[model samples]
Target: MNAIIHILQTQSNGILEALGQHISISLISLFIAAIIAIPLAIILMTHKRIAEIILQITSILQTIPSLALLGILIPFVGIGTIPSIIALVVYAVMPIFQNTYSGLTTIDPNLEEAAEAFGLSRTKKLIKFQLPLAMPMIISGIRIAMVMIIGTATLAALIGAGGLGTYILLGIETNNNALLLIGAILSAILTLIFSALINGISKLSLKKIGILFSVVVVLFGGFAGYRSFVKPTVNVTIAGKMGSEPQILINMYKELIEQDHPNMKVSLKPNFGGTSFLYKALESGSVDIYPEFTGTVLESLVKTNKNVSHNPEKTYQVAKDLLKKQANMEYLKPMQYQNGYDLAVKRSFAKKYNLKTISDLVRVEHRLHAGFDPDFYQQSDGYPGIKKAYGLDLASVKTMEPSIRYKAIANGKVNIVDGYTTDPEIQEYDLVALKDDKNHFPPYQGAPLMTEKFAMKHPEIKTTLNKLSGKITTADMQKMNYLVTVKHEKASKVAHDYLVSKKLLK
Candidate 1:
């Protein structure tokens, strides 16, 4: 409880900012859904067959997984608030459409008939009679949709749309229960607040409702216009993939760049997703820069089948050349750390099995229960490479999120897990990284990556970033990761301290 309070007090500003974003996104998505669905429901009233078809399509859309829908939309719409809102709106439409249609169709037929008998036109009858009678049901649907949107909007954080989910994802990645609780609690509160507000709106007369909606629309539109037209002093967006390392590294990037160019503003999207998401964001111009691993650049981004030399410099050179040639992205000089993949086991377990190398795992392979990150489990250069090089195949392997695997290994839920060489959990959990005796894994030096066009446009920024080249050693990174993940220290502070210690920041 004290920890939670301390965190809340320390991060109050960030929490409020995320809350505001969450509310904005949820309301906008709900508003858009209402505009599209309510009107369509009205139109479909006279055409039952068409209404059924449209409602069915919307139901199908709702069934599409949220993350999958977001991924599908990324290339077309890019990341951040737009894609997040679109995905939420997709989920919001079905309930609103269905409920409105049903409410109108099922309204006391007598009332509708009387409105017609009184010489009312179709549009007049809809406005003066049918809509008012069906108000309760329509409000109910909106309420349901609002609640769902508020909950799901948390995922917007995954694609760099700021929200409480930032705290949630950070908590999960760092094993901070307090942070997780804060995000979940806040989201639940927001849902309740919106649900109650919708219920209040339901009680208003139709004319009042229309007036309220008009006011809201105007406010929303004006805010959107202001953001679109108003430029920041000098804005540069930097994003990072999930994990403490990326979060810390991106903070370092932000601090360094801002120190060099005080007039410049840096927007950070930390724990923004995995490699593919960040790369796509960069490609789409949604993000200006991000930290990336040299090995990942070669293996995942470039997707080259050519062999990469084991030496760090050679691997970095190959990745740098390929990224520039194929993707038109500039790879900056990397820090002096090889955060490559390694298989680790509890130190006691390794000692018991006398496992000193990847080959040594062969003896215990049949008995080992291994947990791996999803990417490592599927990538050829990951598990497949280990299988081929060491001829060790674990009988039990479970693919899980990167953060979960650490807990799994610590709890003895799994005896072995795939981990990065510099992962803090290795030290936290007393795990031993077996030697890749056959050099199955390539060196993975971390570096800032940006499009060539952006690099050319801001040569000074490039110079500012290059100051970090070959600076952070493997031990330096491991210690910083440990500080953020295990000690629950803020990433920004850790980054700043590291730079100050190295005299890179004044």
Candidate 2:
């Protein structure tokens, strides 16, 4: 609890920024869903068949997994706020639409009849009678949708739409319970506050409700207009894949660039999904730069079947050339570290098994329970490569999130787990990384990846970032990761300290 309070105090500005983003996206999504669903419900009151079809579609949409939906939308709409809001609006629509329709359709028959007997026109009857009666139900629907939106909006951070989820993802990756608690608790509090606010609004008179709605519309509209037309443009937007290493690297990039060009505005989007998401963001111009690994470029991005040389420089050269020729992107000079894949086990377990190398794994393969992150489990250069190279296959394999797999191995839930060479958990858990005797995994030197056009337009930015070339070593990255993940230090501060220690920054 003290740790949580300390983090809250230290990170208050970031928390508030994330909270503002969360509120903006959630409210906008709810408002848009209301605009779409309520009017459609009212119009469909006279068209039951059409209404059923539309509602069924919404129900089907609601059943689709949120992450899957976000992935599908990325190709068409790109990432960040737009795609996040669209996905949220989809989820928010069904509840609002269903309740509004039900409220109107289920009005007391006698009261409706009395309104009709008073010679009220359809429009006048809806305004004076049906709408007022249905207001409570509409508010109830909005409340439900608002709560849902707030909860799911955390995921917006994954696609570079800044929100409270940034802390959540960072917390998970770094194993920081204080950060995780902050995100979860704040989200819960937002839910309660919005729910209570809706309840209060539900008790208001019709005139007051109308006035309140008008105010909301105006406010949302003004906010939208300001974002679209008035907001200052960010000169450089740098992003990173999930993990403390990427976050730290991007912070280094940001600091170096800003130090060189003090007038330039740079935005850092940390924990911005995985390699594919960041790559796509860069390709689509959503992000100007991100840290990427050479092996990932060869194995995942370019998908070349050509044999990659084991030499670090050769591998980076091949990746750099391929990216330039095929994708119109440039891969900058790589750092000295090789954050490649490795299989790690508890030191005691390794000692007991007499495991010293990848080949040694074959002896214990039949008894080993393996935990792996989804990427390592599925990628050819990952588990499959190990199987082919070392002729090793474990007795059981479970694919889990990257952060959870570390815990699994550390807690003895699994005998072994896939890990990166520089992962701080190797030290934290006292795990021994078995040598890759067969040299199955290629060198994975990290570098800044960006579009050639952006590089050309901002040549000075490239020059500024390349100052980090060959600067950070495996030990440096491991220590930085340890500071952020194990000690719960801020990634930005760690990056800044590293730069100052190296005399790269004043």
Candidate 3:
């Protein structure tokens, strides 16, 4: 049930957009393979030994893991959709190439002998008779290649190619079954439709329908390739707590300035990573824009901010001042979203203990088993700080990844879990995000920071992003977050829903 809802949500936010990315990789890769392989296969059939060696070599490329192969290609091809498509195409080669080779070579040698006996030229024999007869097998190979490419294309999602695999991976990271289901179902549906199309074409006379199918594949594939890899100037990467925020603002920018206003390309590159790493990526210029928190950037990155717990607007002002002088960045308008850190226990346990705030935990702190993410366990902003601020000393502290700790709490393995106040699971499982009465955690309001140059060039982007500011309350952002990170719902879908619910997307 959750899975179905999740799929519907992702589909809403350009699930077709992701489908476009994945299919583009598959179709283009397969098309290029077809062009290269078909001619080579024809030549190989004529000259036996070289083709055997080449086919064997191509088979080895198929065995490389798609992720590893793509990683190796990234340095040379750079990022975005190109390296991904190239890798998928390389993966798609063997079956199609071999099939082409097999289709041409396996023909009853007598047909060629007869053509030779009739004094037909070699080119005429291939063009008139051989190519037509090889259609069924060649098409069969393409069909297999297409199916293989679809599955391999999932790997491209890891490299930011953006596809159904994005949902699949997010599901895995967060243990969201709905996301896994959405990924599986979408991929299955696409493959089924494509298979039917290929089978339908094969049923048509070899003289014409095959040409039509091939042409469509080539045209769509080529266009997709040009769009994904060739275009996309001015990249902006955002991740961690602010992972989905850019999707909203980016689409808005795409619609308004890039579409409504023009001649400026804005690529909102989303990178999912820990806070520290995301900061590093931003500093190095790997990301042009990121949705970040006001207090976190101040406290964690620039310690001169006096650890002052200020309001959202004040924090943004502080961030703007600090970022300009230090990081040369600008914090745009902030959404009414705050992702403050919080602690949680199972709902039943909380209810039984009447635990409402951090102070309440002091009485039972020693009795509870606390699990915190590794980074949070010892960091000043993590478990250590929470314990220091609340004065609640626990009996046992287990340091694990955030996802693992959440799972532990969910399964009753731990009585306490480190949590984000805005995490979607807090609402989903009804786990209470404790009131930070003592003010232990810093504020992390959802906000975007962009390069000064990009900002000056496109004022409309800031305007588009500013629309989302204050549009989502902390609780509302929590629900959207759950719909994605926990529920395995698509980010685009979650964003679209929030937009529609608010009538932002009429």
lDDT of 1 by residue, 1-506 (tens): 99899988988998998998899999999999999999999998989999999988999998998877887887789888999999999999999999999999998878877887899998899888899988998999999999999889999999989899998998999999999999999999988888888999999999999999999999989998897789575489999988899989999999999889998999998988877788888998888999998888877899687887888999999999999999999999998888999999999998898999989989878989999997798776799878887887898999987888999999989999999988999888899999988888988899999999999999999999999998998899999999999999999999999999999999
After superposition, the stretches of candidate 2 with alpha carbons farther than 4 Å from their true spots are 223-231
Query: Model 3 residue 232 lDDT?
Result: 58
Q: What is the lDDT of candidate 3?
A: 0.71
Q: If ranked by TM-score, best first, what sequence of candidates would result?
A: 2, 1, 3
Evaluated against the true structure, the overall lDDT of model 1 is: 0.90
TM-score winner, 1 or 3: 1
Model 1 clashing residue pairs (backbone):
none
lDDT of each: 0.90, 0.90, 0.71
State the lDDT of candidate 3 residue by residue for 459-482, as single tens digits.
777776677677678677666656
Q: What is the clash tally of candidate 2?
A: 0
